[model samples]
Target: MPDIYRALGDSTRRRILSMLKQGNKTQKEIVDAFDISQPAIKKHLTILLEERMISERLNGKYRIYSLNLSILQTAYQEMLHYIGELLDEQLISLKNYVEKGEFRDEDD
Candidate 1:
């Protein structure tokens, strides 16, 4: 989805996603993983949450962040669909060229 793409467009967000992929992490743990300020990390996490790319659960007073794998799966499916469409068009063009006898093989 566009939201996912927008959220992933930033390197910081992408890195955060990679970090979450390893396992869920607390806000402090996430902040420690990066050289960025805690506020900046929180901002990235907020965007990821808004895009549904990540989810948060409260563990007592701590907030644990985890990757929303389903959201990523959806994005992967969309990409596959787009690639299929492109391949279909190319195949159709090849078919047309062959029917017109315009596609001559080098071996021929």
Candidate 2:
């Protein structure tokens, strides 16, 4: 989904996801891992939350966030499929070119 791609577009957000992949973490815990300000990290978390890449739960005074693996897996699979289709198209074009004797060898 476009949301997933957008959520993954930033290195900071990707790192946050990688952290969540290890285990659930509190907002403070996530904030501590990076050198950036808490508000900056919070913004990245918000985007991840909006994309449903992470889920949040209130625990007393703390909010815990965890990766939503199913959503991530679905997005990853779809991206792989898209990449495979592109590669397949390129290969088909190369095959056609060769078949028509139109491919050139620079060494020749």
Candidate 3:
């Protein structure tokens, strides 16, 4: 799932995934939607494909890519774990601050 996360870490790749989430698209179709070159889009697609986040199929002369939802569950679980840990730490700090009366009420 590291690969999936890494691939998605880029803004461009994330945008591509957002588009894919709407529906399947050919590499050409994906490129046409943006001002970037076809090769650039293909590179992003390659990363997503390598990470198993998307799958491609050959149709005639066109290669179509579709989102793979299977890996999403694992990725989501990993992200959830990290977020939970962060929240836990922050909550503990907030509790300690409250106990010390370090925070002032909004009214003054």
Candidate 4:
């Protein structure tokens, strides 16, 4: 999870992941899509690969990258769980405040 957050922290890497989500793309295709140098793109790809956000395979001499849907799905689920916990905490606080009669009408 920490790895996921780290990988997603970079805008370049995020764009790389987004591009891969459309479909598998060759290293050249990815490099061409970005304005940065090939080496720069390669570095971003490396981080994404390390985080398991994307997978790569050799198609002949070219390296093709694709999104790892399972990992993204896991990340999505984890985010939902964290959000639910936060909402639950807020709701409990609200309930307690209401029960304590913290809110009062001006006429009261």
Candidate 5:
């Protein structure tokens, strides 16, 4: 599986994903939304494609891109599970610390 985290690390890539979520768009349309050059937008689109977060098809002379909902949903669930695991670990640590009486009273 592609590293969805790496693909999502950039703001431009996130914005491109958001745009596709609304509906499919051509490369020109996507580039027009940002002030950056077409080459920069192309780079972002390539990352999204590599991560399988979006799909691209040749629509005549233009390439149309659409959000890959299933892949994105799977990534979202994985992220949630990962975050839950971290929270659980922190809670367990807090519980152990409290049980050990490591924290002193403010008056003390």
Candidate 6:
């Protein structure tokens, strides 16, 4: 969970992840898409790799990166659970308000 939060904490990493989702890309290609330095891009990749959110393959001299998708599943599941709970709470609140005559009219 900490890794998920850390991986999502940086905008550069998020951009890299989004790009990788489209297709695999070499280190040079990822760096070219950003205005930052190569070393900076490498740092972001390192964090993402440690979190297992992305994977890399050595293609001769180039390291190609792609999204792992599995580890990212935890983050997505967490978000879904949170959203479901919020919606349930709101529905209960609406029900209570209606029952208590705090949000009702005779128009119906």
Q: After superposition, how far is residue 40 of candidate 2 from its true place, in Å?
A: 0.8
Misplaced by over 4 Å in model 1 are 97-108
lDDT tens digits, residue span 1-108, model 3: 546568878988898889999999988889988888888888988888888888999999999988888787787787898989999999999999999998889999
Q: In candidate 5, what are the lDDT values of residues 13-95, reduced to their tens digit? A: 99998999899999999999999999999999999999999999997899999999899989999999889999999999999
Q: Which stretches of candidate 2 lie over 4 Å from their true place?
A: 105-108
Q: Report RMSD (Å) for each prediction in the order shown.
A: 2.4, 1.6, 2.7, 1.7, 1.1, 2.8
Q: Where is model 4 poorest over a 10-residue stretch in terms of lDDT? A: 1-10
Ranking by TM-score: 5, 2, 4, 1, 3, 6
Question: What is the lDDT for 38 in model 3?
Answer: 83
User: How far in Å is the alpha carbon of 33 misplaced in model 6?
Assistant: 1.1
Greater lDDT among 4 and 6 belongs to: 6
Q: lDDT, candidate 6, residue 52?
A: 88
TM-score-best of 5 and 6: 5
What's the CA error at residue 17 for candidate 1, in Å?
Answer: 1.1
Per-residue error for 15 in candidate 5, Å, reads 0.9
How well is each residue in 1-108 modelled by candidate 6, as lDDT tens digits? 626878989999999999998999999999999999999999999999998899999989999999887778877898788889999999999989888888646796
Candidate 5 Cα outliers beyond 4 Å, as residue runs: none
Please report the candidate that would top lDDT against the real structure. Answer: 5
Candidate 5 TM-score over all chains jointly: 0.94
For each candidate, how many residue pairs have backbone atoms clashing (under 3 Å)?
Answer: 0, 0, 0, 0, 0, 0
Candidate 2 lDDT by residue in tens digits, 24-104: 999999999999999999999999989899999999999999999898889889889989999999999999999998977
Clashing pairs in model 2, backbone N/Cα/C closer than 3 A: none
lDDT of model 1 at position 35: 93
| Among all candidates shown, the one with the greatest TM-score | 5
Which pairs clash (backbone N, Cα, C closer than 3 Å) in model 3?
none
Query: All models: lDDT?
Result: 0.90, 0.92, 0.87, 0.90, 0.94, 0.90
